[model samples]
Target: MTSLAPSGHLTIGEHQLEYRMIGPSPAEGPTLVLLHEGLGCVGLWGDFPDRLAAATGADVFVYSRAGYGGSSPVQLPRPVDYMHREALDVLPRVLDAIGFRRGLLIGHSDGASIAAIYAGGVPDHRVRGVSLIAPHFIVEDTSVQSIAEIKTAYETTELRTKLAKWHKDVDNAFYGWNDAWLDPAFRAWDISDHLAYIRVPMQIVQGADDQYGTLKQIEIAEAECYCPVEALVIPGAGHSPHREAAEATLRAVAEFADRILNGHGEAAHGQAA
Candidate 1:
């Protein structure tokens, strides 16, 4: 397949998602598919994708899901199973559309959970491993509290104004994620079953000071996954470790991608599931 442009829109179903491609094409080497956080978009990723591609010597693809960035705006009040739908429905089409031969899925927050679900649910042998930053396996009271506070901030403060620089329809991106999580039915949302079924190595990076979730999220991965699970906890960091601890986060993620994509992946992974 030919290499993708530096940036463009991908028409998936009715949605036209925005994306940026860096480094080699999938045919040249491995690829890294970055799934952004609930409110994150391709623009919000900044130059992290460039740094990652340079560090790993692999293609880096960053995209904004529906309702975020320049992507098509989704209907408000996304389903409680929104992340699940992204993993099982949207992400696969994305990977296929890009002609991804083999690679890693690096995700943040909600994106991390979706990566977990996809790696475990899809039978695609092309995906080598997963790198999760501040992943959520199950909902927590603290998570709810933090999200509520953010909602308050978005509504009363300039958070929406700041976020508007990224999303064309900011309210759709904000409420789509905020409303679903705050919904009472979403409290029971647990994706641990997906963790148990993952057959590839998994690396989880977390912020020690993350208010949205606790170390219990990593504990769940350790308990449920039969595959190798390595945790990297960054001190004095919160929710988005990649931003709070930029250099360290980039190095760690790049190293993990290198290890897994190269022939040494299996040696580090132990027994595959």
Candidate 2:
């Protein structure tokens, strides 16, 4: 495995992606790779990575995709198939770049979808399980409506200014995700087909009141996946259960990682303080 700095930039193709490695390295133990939600970057995740690492005992890897955080900029009006491209093209390179040996993918929203696409589409044996929080297997009317509303907030409120702190190219980060979802053709965007291909056990977490998606996403995973599937629904939370319900979310993710990685129900790794 490559020697990783605590935090630094990784050159993957044309982009220099910003990343953080918390706790143990891949060579030391199992790894948990975090895929952030749309409009999210390394900074937005705050201390969640360190907390997750402590809870799971496995190393936690977090990175900002192109155009997010301090990473390189990407073309505007991102392709509707952008998630697919990231799953099939960029994420593989990232895993290889980090010398990932064996690990699980823990993704939120867009990142969740990307992980599903990668695990389902790619036959990489290194990925042992997938945990999705507020994932979308298919585009929902709620998703489109929420995205449109956020765009309005970005223009009319301080949302852009707040996000600007994390993204070097805020508009690129915002519209790349915003414009693609709003595109009429994107309504047909669905990756539930990917569910049928996943071979590993799966864990899914969602808020009871996630504005971006609904329980239907969970139903879709249960209906299509042949692998073992488990889910957690955090009440009074929104799209980001990890933020809105941090402690519960951390415990769930930690337990799932421990059980799947160690072949037991108990957490084999020591919790970080």
Candidate 3:
């Protein structure tokens, strides 16, 4: 149940990323890597990381990507392929730098997409399972509309001021994600092809009332992925289930991680009939 402060930094390429570690040491049980959402960072995760650690007894490694929190800033107008680049390029290095052993990826929104891409693209044996919260597998009108609404809020409301507290370069953090999603070409952005390649068990958690995405995201996983896929739709929760419905999300994630990492079930592979 030990929670360590996020006083560590790792150099990935030219960027300095800020991260926090909780629970047992790396030599202990499997690690849970917490990947933040589009506008999220290490600080934005609040007490969820600590609670997850205490509940599962697994080391939780949470980090702020470039241009967010205390991490290095990035150029504006990020490419629409940013998530793909992060999953294929940056995540592998981060895992290596952290000496990642056996692990499970717990990701939210943009972070969840990255985890899905990585699990499908890389042949890393260290990744045992994936828990995706509010993940988007395809571009939907609802997601775009929500992103547009947030953009307006950022410009006119206190959202920008609130986010500034978490991001060192708030504009870069916001615009990078906002602009990419709102771009006309991004409407065709889809990661459903990646799901077919994922070899590990996966748990997809989404809020029943998630404004940013629809249940179609989970349906794609069930239809495409060769691995076992479980879906949870929490009522009264929105896009950020881990934040909106913390207790329920924590219980589901903790149980799934325990089962996958502790060898409590049969292997999860092969296409569904």
Per-model TM against the reference? 0.95, 0.96, 0.94
Tell me how far candidate 2 lies from the true structure as C-alpha RMSD in angstroms: 3.4
The runs of at least 3 residues in candidate 2 whose Cα sits more than 4 Å from the true structure, single-residue gaps closed, are 266-273
Residue-wise C-alpha lDDT for candidate 3, range 214-237, written one tens digit per residue: 989988999999998988888889
Residue-level lDDT of model 2, residues 44-64, one tens digit each, is 988888998888778999999
- The Cα RMSD in angstroms, rounded to one decimal, for candidate 1 relative to the true structure is 3.4
Ranking by TM-score: 2, 1, 3
lDDT of 1 at 171: 95
Angstrom error of the Cα, residue 54, model 1: value is 0.9
Error of 1 at 247 (Å): 1.3
The 10-residue segment of model 1 with minimum total lDDT is 264-273
Cα error, residue 183 of model 2, in Å, equals: 0.3
